[model samples]
Target chain A: MKLTRRMFIQGAAAVTALMAAPRALLAWPEKAFKAGSSDEVMQALFGSADVTESGSVVLNAPDIAENGRVVPISVSSSLDGVENISVIVVENPSPLAASFDLGPGASAAVSTRIKMGKTSNVIAVVKADGKLYSAQKEVKVTIGGCGG
Target chain B: MASDIRIKAKLTGDTAEVKTLMKHDMETGTRKDKKTGETVPAHYITEVKCELNGKLVMTANWGPAVSKNPYFAFTVKGAKAGDVLKVSWVDNKGGGSSAETTLG
Candidate 1:
């Protein structure tokens, strides 16, 4: 219990060794595709996003997914002149998710099927001209798929 | 095994539906055998093609970005009833198969 230099050095060595381990070992390789948490996905998308409780960006997905293996997701934006759109799955191994490039004269909507691996909140981040807007929905995965 | 390749499709007035399943290992090139520690070679499907009534309808380019047992669904116009829809896929290993279904 007394202050000992030898003990402190030993503790420091252990801590350093623990930090040396690979990041993948600590967390499963969910990557960006398995995003399941809404809040975390937005945080990943904007670092901090201004999300209002509005139905401007229609995120279509089952409130309760019958299976966790595969879920169909669709994101459509009502804002005119939509320039860019991204989808983030918060709880997935990777958090940045998928991004779409919407050029001028392009439709402001996108729909894609993504693998969840588990229950997650799917979030859509839309970039209009120079502005950023977002919409979110909770998708519950009842059964794990994609080797979940 | 190659014997498991399958493709099922249908074409409706102004719309086409296609479904396909392929036999593949889909190894991501990162996974290693638990006992051997030797890295497994990547063997995944990389592309899929679906034609509606003999016209190109949907083409999907998949990379290591896709998951195993990949399934895709898409619709395209210009397909009339009583036409033929064909689906095919080419894997990373270059194994390919095709199947055709008549419009309903």
Candidate 2:
């Protein structure tokens, strides 16, 4: 009876670990997210802030956002071998909003909603063929999103 | 409990567009409560993963700047109408949720 109970406990523990193994493998970039500025974020995540302005990278955002709480933003790249795309709000306290890593079978575009703390330049950074390219658009916010 | 993720997928030609909306407060941890005068703890989705027919295709890393009820959209290549698309997210507080949909 004692042996059976011990085996059951060990089985349960193994199952729990198996269930969590996948997520644990994809470790979150905590340092990049906590970086206060766009330059810092780039350094923390990509090891450099060097990015060339590119026309192939398109950043779509409103000229004036009535609601800063939910601003629609979309980014697309015509460049081949696009592996990663990141959105940055320059004026936000923490500028690195989101980053998307695309597999080979995935396209080089993404659309999402982000919060803007104030009027800021929204930048789309694309990593294609191991090189970083960026595009930026200034968005005016009537109301801030980070206020309490 | 009801699933916190809503997913929609459509196959156009050889490409499949997958869109997902996740329910999350995404508290920035900088907001103060009006009644209690205490700052709200940070609660936000930090990672999201997308799979096409059980194969990983895309991974999204998000920060607090992502708005509440995050909406994300991406496209996958070489997908069929009946293919299954799965999306899951994990929050900073260790909470997670997932949902799947068949491509139309």
Candidate 3:
């Protein structure tokens, strides 16, 4: 192919225009997330929940996280009946990501996945019978997370 | 792949405080595959166990209907400050989790 002055100018202009395109224009407010381990989040969510460890409340996660960017956690209760269920993480800039309102007939458990910016503790706090309780586990974040 | 799962415990008179955070993917089955033109098989931990010093506190099970990562918080009785508390769980694929903490 032969090069032409007019063609070169046109290509350059197109390249510049493409490079100047704004990302927000491509995907405006897609799926936003709150980053944290879990503990920092529950404390902020509960404030002061007479929180305690209960065998009736169970939380399950991995022992070693292949990636810290995405970790899974589960919280459940078997206290005859459940009033509410909530999930929180500590370490993110904004800790509280979700809060579930459980009614008299609602399930006694709520499970969800969370992104950890780094190695930190995953905390789960439960509210039952007008009282508050909590549980936590240390997620060994090996891979890069939020910043990485 | 976390090891030595542990929880924190505190005691204020008859009230026992326990905190736990497990490590697993509460995977939502709505994601797609980039290369196969199909969806990736739903994979996640589906169950958990919270024990207060060897006594069953709570047990929870979930499915793709849950969130990405999950956390649970609650309180139990019969545990005193300086005593031991144990937590464990079994996943959908038979994976197991265990953690221990001391009250106060």
Candidate 4:
């Protein structure tokens, strides 16, 4: 094989394509993460803040969080066609904690740990069949997780 | 460098429960250093993906509020034993890591 200008250009193009593939496949919602309020986050991520309170969307969390640094939370839904699940800490500096997009063959349940800045309501929002449903629980934090 | 992920996938009935623990600082950028009195820069995983046998089953987008050393668990239907399950993540600083496990 011999090196040529055309080969160099072709190689550069391939490298650029390779680097661009992941960004195109998975787009991180930077605006939503920077949103200070839950409503703003909802608007940035889903384009709406209208969420119906539903019992079918279950949010499991501790009643009193002794340490706000690592509060465990789990969200599960009995509704069919559950497409997305998000956890929001209402009192955090930026409320949107985590968001999970469920695909086909994936269950409508997820568990994770989050940091809470203060005692506040933890909202679990589920998107099923293009409709948004939510459930909230208040967790009291003795110590804040933000700073001293 | 050593891998930054620990994963386990177990098959129960017809579903495979996949759990992953990622090693990260998850700094919220709001916290100030106690000694320096300066705000620490935010460093956290922004995206996580789970694939079963080369097909994506789940994707998660995280904010700075996620705890340090995040633990995440989910289930995949129709996953059987010996299926390859891969969990990977990318952080805000362009750092990324991945780990794979077989459902057993």
Candidate 5:
């Protein structure tokens, strides 16, 4: 077999075709993602919407997000016996963003990037000693980044 | 083959700052293919865990709302140089990957 320009083009087309094929597997939160309000999403995710504001739970985020598609967020708790952490965007269609379960040996800190539909309050909820403590920061999103 | 996840852990004073970048699409299933005009199926990491010297340091639960090729960073208190750090993840499709490094 001899290499030719035609063969190279054919190979490139084959590679593109393979990439275009639909991927299989994976499950998503259909009901939770479809929820219209923060309360509904919170109820579906954590079984409650009532979170007490606390200064011990520190939420670090930008005051004005350059983009909504990738907003950096970090959470840390100084409270003892903290076992879990949760992130929420109060103005998004499906507000419950992310959650973490910390083990006894694990430190009470987490960081990740999240998408927001618009300007909203970013909330960090830390579960310690079976009680929920939270902190919030308002982030203004720029044009055309995440969600509708 | 499981995709390779890149991780780095370095000591900053008594704390260890860790950074991770994983190769993934993180599809939300809401976006449509421009050519075929069909909704893409959801595929994203649902969980992530980090450990320091064999002890759990952090764990995260994620959703499709996260961006593609996710990047994460955090710090572990009381960590020091030469300590072992490990990071692992499992996607919604049951796919998983892991990587480990010694704090430098």
Candidate 6:
């Protein structure tokens, strides 16, 4: 096949177009992930809504964390039809930590290690039966988890 | 290439406790590269799914805010020993990895 400038240019354009296409489909929540405050992050994630405090939702974390970088946290809810569970570190630069979506028949529990920029309130928000409920605990961090 | 996910599950009565550790940089895209001084692109696990014996059991949605080398654990109801448990993750870049283990 004879190489032509027109064909080469068209091929290059097609390749570039293909390269840029998938990025648009990338499911990263940019605004919510970059939001500074927990409220703003939650608003971006779940819209402007009120979350009720629930005793059925449990948020477990150390009261005094020696290392901010690896704070253990767990969230479990006994509420029926639990759909979503999320972890948020209030004082972190990017406060929204991790989010989980549980399917039907899945237990309402999630555990993970997250970084805390400093002493902060770790919040667990659970969505059950289309209602938002939350539980939080204050953790004192001696050193910043993200850095230092 | 081999996946970097390490998962373990143990059945106790009617519930199976599952623990997993995924090795990743989890770059938030906000941090600067030390050498180039450029903002690193945000790259982290966006979705995680668990299947028990080919049936979807749990799923997770994460962001760059998760720490490097993310560790996650959960429980699966009605799981039993010798059941196949598969854990998989897809990152923001669309790269995916999965590991399977049998509950013990």
DockQ of each: 0.06, 0.72, 0.07, 0.74, 0.32, 0.54
In candidate 1, which residue ranges exceed 4 Å CA deviation? A1-114, A117-148, B1-5, B10-12
| lDDT per residue as tens, model 4, A1-148 | 4668889999999999999999876788878888988999899888999999999999999999999999999999999999999999988888999999999989999999999989999999999998899999999999988765
Docking quality category of candidate 4 according to DockQ thresholds:
medium
Worst 10 residues of 3 chain A by lDDT: A26-35
Q: What are the lDDT figures for the candidates, one per model?
A: 0.59, 0.92, 0.57, 0.92, 0.78, 0.84
Off by over 4 Å in 3: A1-47, B1-104
Compose the digit string of candidate 5's lDDT tens values, residues A1-148.
4678889999999888777554312233445556767667666556677778999999999999878888889999999998878788888756767777777655688788888778999888888997888999999988534433
A1-148 per-residue lDDT for model 2 (tens digits): 9999999999999999999899667878788888988999888878889999999999999999999999999999999999999999999999999999899879999999999999999999999998899999999999999965
What lDDT tens digits, residue by residue, belong to model 3 across residues A1-148? 3568889999999888887677334321112123233443444444553577777777787877787655776677777656556655455444553455454423465555566556666666678776776677777778734432
Report iRMS values in order.
7.2, 0.8, 9.4, 0.8, 2.9, 2.1
For candidate 6, the per-residue lDDT at A62 reads: 100
Best by DockQ: 4
Q: In candidate 6, which residue pairs get closer than 3 Å at backbone N, Cα or C atoms, i.e. clash? A: A68-A145, A69-A145
lDDT of 6 by residue, B1-104 (tens): 33699987778997998999999988776677788888888788988889999998887778665678999999888887788999999988879999999887
> In model 6, what is the error at residue A11, expressed in angstroms?
21
Deviation of model 1 at A131, angstroms: 14
TM-score per candidate for chain A alone:
0.62, 0.83, 0.63, 0.84, 0.72, 0.80
* Candidate 6 lDDT for residue A133: 93
Q: Candidate 5 on B1-104: residue-level lDDT in tens?
A: 33478887778787877788898888777667888888888888987888888788777778776667888877777877788888999998889998888887
Worst 10 residues of 6 chain B by lDDT: B58-67
A1-148 per-residue lDDT for model 1 (tens digits): 6568878999999888788666334222233223445555445434555565446777787887776545666666878766556666665544444455454423455454555556777777776655677777888888754442
Q: Lowest lDDT 10-mer window, candidate 5 chain A?
A: A22-31
